[model samples]
Target: MELFVFVCAAIMVLVGALGVVLRSNPVHAALSMILTLFGVAVLFVAREANFLAAVQVIVYAGAIVVLFLFVIMLLGVDRAEDLRTEPLGNVQRPLALVLGIGMFALLTTAVVRSRDSLRFKGDGVKTATLEDADGNIRQIARSIFGDYVVAFELTSVLLIVAVVGTVVLARRRKSERTAS
Candidate 1:
């Protein structure tokens, strides 16, 4: 049953990824990304990372995808276009292909050569005990608030700044249109 769920989620992820890459429509691509995010959430659940699964669904699939669609609709990029035309000229396609293949080769070489370095070298991860109902949550909270508090706070501030900036830009544009 576990294997079946994993396989199904993996397939969903792969198909969604392909849809994201291959779809010409921005809305369709964003929807595909949602599918990918949901599949990732399922995989996180399979790994017993319930918090991460919830974050994946709520933060990525919900908030981030909504932001993407909002931006797409705001910028009016939902129209069909000629996919064959190269906006960056003929050189970019070949250059991109070469760079992609080189990157793949480098990644493959690193993974093959660094097999031993991937093992966990630190002490065992601290997990919640069976008796403590909120052990996992407590440990996660401590790790996030105690160890990575600054990073977490900074991320929140940055997101807030981004939202404010977007709103300001949109208001400015609207005022300009009214003035015009």
Candidate 2:
């Protein structure tokens, strides 16, 4: 049963990933990304990471995807862009390809070197069980709220500041446009 669930979730993830890459429409791609996120959430559930699964669905699938769709709609990407246009000149593609190959080579070398050292060493860690499903979540909550509460609250304040800054900049641009 668990194997079946994992296989189904894996298939959803792969299909959604392909949709995200292959779809030409930004809205469709964002929807595909939601599918991918849901699949990942399902996988997290299978791994007994309920908190992570909820975060995956709520934060990524809900908030992030909606933001992406909003940006896509706001940008009005309905018009097809010319693929042949070299806005950055001919050097950009070659540079990107070379850099991509170099990064891939570096990652491959790192993986090969570290493959043997990547063994799981969870010695005294408590995992979720049927009797205590919230145990893992409680531990995570304690670590975050107890040990890192200040940092977490600081991050929220930073995000709020960023949102306010963006709104101010947007309003300034609109006023400038109207004045012009």
Candidate 3:
């Protein structure tokens, strides 16, 4: 049952990734990214990483995707306009297909090779217990506050900048429309 769920989640994640890459419209791509994040969260839950899964859903699928959608809506860019200026040409399609296939083959080979050499004593989920949870959480908190403090701070700053930028852009658009 778990294996089946994992397979389904993996398939969903792959399809979502492809959708994100292949969708011409930015909004559709952002929605696909949200789908991908949700699939990943499902996988995390299946693996018994409940806390991480919750965080993934809340932070990524909820906050980040909403932010992405807000930015896309605020930009007021038409999907038709973007499609007209697509970077890829018909001549490159075959080459791109071949390259993608080759990359997939390489990745499959790597996974097959890595799986053989891996050794496990017990089920990983069983080992990820509540007794260890407190220590792990403490370590993570310390690392986030210490080694990754600058990155954490920078992320907050970036988010603030994005919010301000979105407000300014929307206001400018509103003013322009009024003037027109």
Candidate 4:
């Protein structure tokens, strides 16, 4: 069951990546990236990283993607002209292709090596230390407040800034229209 879910999530992520790369419209690309982030979150949940999964969905899928979409909408990018400009042409094309191929080969080698070396005992997965609900909750609380407090605070501040900036931009646009 877990394997099946993982496979589906992987497929979704791959399709989303392709869509992000191939789509002509910036909005579509941003949406695709959101889908990719959602798949990653699902994968994290399947792996029993519940807190991480929630953070992935909340931070990346919800906040970051919405910000990206808002920026795309605010810019009012011309779809036709944006599509016409081949940004990856000329000098960057061959370099990008070579780098991509090299990265793929390196990743493939690493995966193969890891699979061959890594061994699983019993049911093939280690039992998590915080198995009980209360234990898990405590573990999560400690990790967040103890180790990641600064990061958590920073994320909240960042979100606040994003919200304020969006409102300011919208108000400025409305004031400009009224003046005109």
Candidate 5:
């Protein structure tokens, strides 16, 4: 049963990724990202990291993706033609392809070489201190609030700025139309 769930989640992740890459429209790509985030949450649930799964769903799938769609809609970038311009020059596509292929080869080599030597020994040092399910949640909370508080605060401030900037732009457009 677990295996089945994992396989389904994995397949959905792959499909969502492909949708994001292949879709011409920005809104469709954002929707695909939501699907991908959900799939990742499902995988986290399968691993017994329920808090992580909830965070993934709430933070990435719910909040971040909504912001992406909001920006896309606000900017009216849903049209395919608006996205057709490639500013990286004519050689960007071929260069990206070569780099992507090279990265794939390196990753494949690492995985192949590590298969014989690398192994999961335990819950890991970070989580080994966690005695119960609640401990996992506490550990995660500590990591976020205690160790990464500056980054966390910065992210929140950045998100707030983005939302405010969008509203300002929207108001400017409305005012321009009224004055005209």
Candidate 6:
């Protein structure tokens, strides 16, 4: 049944999310991210958003996660971090955890308030679907290019800058080791 499938996908998403946070190894975390993305794609498919689901799998699980793995390998900083060390003194991790939980609670409350719209996918309920003749993805592209073009381009530029910075840092570290 659809309920069963949705439950399974939700469980996989939670497990993958926990793995991403709980795993010490960066590679394992990246792999878990792939799992989380794939699970999200499944949820999209269950919602009848086929194009969105495809893009989620192809772009996020495929390209972005591979980029993450590439950066991890290139930086050669994939070693396990010492979790016991509070490098930021005593106030960082606890504060972060508190903020994270508060944000999660807020988002969960928002989603629960909008639960009616979400019931369409699970119960075969008739609700307003976004797609028509032009398609849901076309609407997405229009918004991305028409309304948020500047932000979109800026995001791409930011990603390129991050990649360049990572490469430069890796090279600098290598040269430092060689000189030493």
Steric collisions counted per model: 0, 0, 0, 0, 0, 0
Write down the worst ten-residue block by lDDT for model 4. Answer: 122-131
Candidate 1 accuracy as TM-score: 0.80
TM-score of each: 0.80, 0.74, 0.66, 0.69, 0.68, 0.66
Tens-digit lDDT string for candidate 1 (1-180): 999999999998989988897788889999999889989999987886777788889999878999999989999999755567638688987898899889989999999999988887764444445777565677788889998999989999998999899797766666788999
lDDT of 2 by residue, 113-177 (tens): 99999888753435788898788888888878998999889999999999999897776666788
RMSD of 5: 4.7
Give each model's whole-structure lDDT: 0.84, 0.84, 0.80, 0.80, 0.82, 0.82
The 10 consecutive residues of candidate 1 with the worst lDDT sum are 120-129
lDDT of 1: 0.84
User: What pairs collide in candidate 4?
Assistant: none
lDDT of 4 by residue, 1-180 (tens): 988999999988988998898788888888889889888989987887777788899989878888888777888872634544777678787798899999999999999889967766543332246456445456677778988999889989998998899797766666788998
Question: What's the residue-level lDDT of 145 in candidate 1?
Answer: 98
* Model 4 regions more than 4 Å off: 78-84, 116-131, 134-137, 147-180
Q: Is candidate 3 or candidate 5 better by TM-score?
A: 5
Q: What local lDDT does model 1 show for residue 36?
A: 90
Tens-place lDDT per residue, model 6, 96-149, is 899999999999999998888665453232323654544566666777899899
Error of 1 at 150 (Å): 1.7
Clash pairs for candidate 3: none
Give per-residue CA lDDT, model 3, range 54-170, as digits (tens).
Answer: 899999988888988887888885253455467768868779899999999999999998996777564223324656755445555677899899999999999899889979766
Cα lDDT over the full model 6? 0.82
What value does the lDDT take at residue 87 in candidate 5? 72
- Superposed on all Cα atoms, the candidates' RMSDs to the truth, in angstroms, are 2.9, 3.4, 5.0, 5.1, 4.7, 5.8
